[model samples]
Target: MFENGIVGSLIMIAVGIVVGFFAGFLYRKKIGESKIGSAELEAGRIIERATADSEAKKKELLLEAKEESIRTKNEYEKEFKERRNELQRSEKRLIQKEESLDKKMDSLERKEEQLQRKVDAVEKQKEELAQKIAEQKDILEQLSGLTREQAKDHLLESVKDEIKVETALLIKDMEAKAKLEADKKAIDILSGAIQRCAVDHVTESTVSVVSLPNDEMKGRIIGREGRNIRTLESLTGIDLIIDDTPEAVILSGFDAMRREVARIALEKLIVDGRIHPARIEEMVEKARKEVEVMIREDGEAATFETGVHGLHPELIRLLGKMKFRTSYGQNVLKHSIEVAHLSGLIAGELGADITLAKRAGLLHDIGKSVDHDIEGTHVSIGTALCKKYRESDIIINAVEAHHGDVEPTNIISVIVQVADAISAARPGARRETLESYIKRLHKLEDIADKYKGVEKSFAIQAGRELRVVIIPEEVDDASLTILAREISKNIEEELEYPGQIKVNLIRETRAIEYAK
Candidate 1:
């Protein structure tokens, strides 16, 4: 039995050894298979990566080639444009040269024609001279009585006499015709200009009237021995005239602006019921500022109404100063506006520059705005103002020449002058005292009477017309026209009158044979 047990144990040991060996071999085979599967997956992934890289590199190369092609195309296009421009410039230069050559050729042809005509005329004159000499010699020979020199002298004397007579008659006819045409045309143009332009005239007084609330307010205004009134006058530079004119006070001053300031200040004081000097001063200052604003506003309004723009700020303010200014009791601002309208109308009718005419007309009297403060005539001052404001040369000339102080250089300047005259000389445009009017009429008559061959002179139609009766023996019928023109010219040069004056010369020969 023991021998059998040992043999079985040995068998068992051997069986265990075999199973262990087989398990070890299967484990080794499974590990080897797993490593092979991982190697295959890594190889597939590497191949995919390499294919994607190759496709990306090919696309990058194609994009680079497209960009290079675009750059080359742009360069070629730019070069083509430059070349085309150069060609065009060359073509233009060649065309201009051709035109110049053509013009020169035409000029040469005209000169040649002129020279040929002159040469032909000289030859014809020589032929006529030779023929005349031959005929004179034959006549001298046939007559055998008079010398050639004597005959020539007789012919010259007769020709001279005929020429003198013919010249006198021609001059007379020309003068008559020219005078008739000029007078008719002038009348037509002036009448048309006057008929087209019409504006209202405004009269301004130096004194301003301010209405008070009651009579008692006057005492407050006077303020304890006129302290308040004196304070106002001193500040505003105007005289306060307090009279028994029923709750109204008169403000008088040569400076219209000052008078206006006083009027405003006084009205404000009365309204506030504060009559002390301190309150008066405050009110005056406020009133002055208000007047300044009003002046600027008036200037702007004038420009707007006249359609004139681009005036300097200083020029506009100066124009406002004319609002309170007066010329022979005519409101200067109104007069300026009327002149502007008249100038524009006349310019339109005459086909002149309307804008320039209106601008000059509006500013023509701007010098009057500062004439009282300045030491020169309004024309000179206005010319200076126009220069300071950089106005055009034409405008400066018009302003300076409107009063005939300077000769007008442009048609617009003439239009401005005519408009100023028309505006100032129109009926009711200005007012004068009875004394001045009488003196002006007497001066007009006196001017006419100063001329020779004047029997009597009468200033008729408010000094707008002058009638002179000349002695027929002293002035002939033809001389009447000359005498009238001379008198008219003398009046224009010597006198200062509104509108144009007519000088009429009447020469009537009276042969009174008394019936027996």
Candidate 2:
């Protein structure tokens, strides 16, 4: 029985334990329900607060949008009003500009009318002036007892005469001044050159004379049958004149060189006393060689004296030939040397090329050396020779133009020309025939006598000065210079003279009254 009771007590303890477990579970469940209800209420309250906040936020956004719309509309209205006011101002300015344009157009119209009226008035005045000019022309034509054309011609002729007189006076005054200056300068230059370079005048004759030691030498020179003389003449191209002149033999030939050769050969044969044909030929050859040597020596001497260098050998030989040549009784070589010296001096004075001037002057007469053989003027031959010799154009021109055959191309040419003239115009430098001298004087007088108011004319001073007598009544003082110049011009055009001619005009009025 005790065992049973123990069992029953254990069982009761188990049951109580179980019941306590269940009560704990039920209390836990109830607590979980209450917490759940509290969580639900908190969640609902959070949701309602969220909904009310969202509504307030939406109302604030709506109010801001309405304020933005109102501000935008007011701004647009203000902009519209400002733009409308600007358009109104612009329209007013355009109206004012239109009005100003209209006023300017009216002013322009008025000015145009004024200009037209002035133009009409000017046209009317021109017509009246034309009529008045016609009337004046008619009245003048009637008063002058001449037609319009005749009166015009008469007036033109009167004006022409007046202008001619005035022009003559001007030319006279200008020529006087120019002559004064030119004369002073020319005289100074020419005189200085002449004084510095004075050359002795020499007249060369074309005749050759050989004097024998005795009268017996003439027959020996004649030889047997004139064989010796014949051989000499044939070889030397000279004439042996055995005249009545005692102890002298004359060699006549146009060529001075041949004459010289003949003279030397004859002299040698005489000295050697070998007068045979063979001996004569030998002596002639020797004389010819000797003459050639002399020619070379002369050429070298001329070059050395004048300081001219670098001449071709042939040219030097030609220059030497000029030593034996003569023109117008003047030695060509000596004339050439004088011309060179004068040209050098004048070129120095005139500031030209002295060396070139001297060279041209020296060679100016080179053509005369061969002029006997050549068929042309000295100038043409000289130019041709210079060109063949490879001379410069300036040298050729100077040679050609020295005689005024051509216009001088350089100052050196002019200097050479003047120097040549001075050399040739020196006293006793050249000679002319009596016939030519008389003819030149007559020409001078004739030229002067042809002019009106020239009563008489006289050529004095070797045809250098022409004295003209003018009628005092016909040629006035104003016209005297004109008349003199006219006569001088005529002389220059018609005459070919060396140096310069002086034109002298003499006007004298003689009134003789005899009272009883």
Candidate 3:
């Protein structure tokens, strides 16, 4: 009975729980439906408001668009009216132009008719004049013995002969005056410059003779089996000559710099009393360093002396290297210094840039320092070096044109050129082999002899002046100027001379009658 009562209780609880759940779900569903219905109503109101706003906006936009269209249409009409008025004005101008053109055409037609009548009259006059000229020519040709062309040629020849004499005289007078003034001024300037400067010059030798204490020291220098001498030679690139000289040894080399180093190192080795290979090497290294120091110091001294500042360090070193350099036996460093002084003097007189001139003058032959190691002429090498060192264009040009290898672009370049010539051409400053000197003199004479009417040519004054003899019968006085100029030009084009060569042209007319 208890089991049946419990089962009834469970069934009653289950029924009650189901009824409560159903009641809550039905209440929520009704509430949700009412909320949805209100939301729908709100949505409908919002859509109606939006639709009303859109309709008003559409009317405003349409009204604005219509107003804009009307405004544009009025503008278009105004433009069209303006265009039509402009077209009417253009048509009126065209009609006026047509009337004016018709009037001009009528006037031009009358003028053309008058011009044609005048042209016909001139044509008749020309034909009559031509007939008269023909008759006159026939009569003149008959009167004269020569034809027209022959007479014209004779007249022209006479006039040409007279003109040639006058031209020759004029050229002579002009050249005389010019040369007189030019020579006077040049002598003054050059004399002044040359007078103010003087430096010791010598014909430097390629070989250096280092004296020794005695004959025994020579063997010491030669070393055991010539090892010491060989080491020095290999290191310094100089040849060692130990001969029958009583107390001297000679160091020979084309490179003065290496020869100098070898001499210093050899002297040091001698003084230190160390003759082994190791000691020789040590001395050589020390000597090299010493020479380098001297080079730098000399470079600095040169810059200070010349007052040329701001040279690249490498350029300074190069200037120092010139101390060991020589050209035609003249000490190159001294030459450069002399050239610098001369350039400054000349520049001062000419009112050129003195500083630039001096600077270029000093650095003009910087290439000689390393010309052996480098190819090309000194001028070319110097130009390349200056350019590489960021030197000014004027400086490079001065160096490049110093040797007449190129045309000078400025006054400084010309000044440098002049100074270089003056320095190089100084008597006793340079020398050449006997064969070359003779060959040059002969070549100069030969160049003068190549021209016509040249009886003889003598290169005198050490080949500085060429005296040319002209056959008086062949070359008249009137033609001497042209012949001299031609010969000078030929010499200039043909010869590579140190300095200026004076061309002295002499024409002699001699009457020699022998009575037997």
Point out where model 2 deviates above 4 Å.
1-204, 426-516
Give the TM-scores of the predictions, in the order they appear.
0.45, 0.46, 0.46
Q: How close is candidate 2 to the true structure, as a TM-score?
A: 0.46
The total of clashing pairs for model 1 equals 0
Candidate 2 residue-wise lDDT, 1-516, digit = tens? 999999999999999999999999999999999999999999999999999999999999999999999999999999999999999999999999999999999999999999999999999999999999999999998898899989889989999989878978998899889999999999999888766654212213546778888999888888898998898888889888899998999888778788789989988887898797889889989999999988888877887787778877777777888998877666889998889899889988988888888888888888888888999998898889888998788889999988878899898888888888787865553556789999999999999998889899999999889999899998877788888888889999999998999999999989999999
Residues forming the 10-long window of minimal summed lDDT in candidate 3: 197-206
* Model 1: residue 295 alpha-carbon error in angstroms: 0.7
The local lDDT score (0 to 100) that residue 377 gets in candidate 1 is: 91
lDDT of 3 by residue, 234-318 (tens): 9999999999999999898878778889999999988888799999999999999999999999999998999899999999999
Each model's total of backbone clashes: 0, 0, 0
Task: Answer with 2 or 3, whichever has the higher lDDT.
Answer: 3
Best by lDDT: 3
lDDT score for candidate 3 against the true structure: 0.90
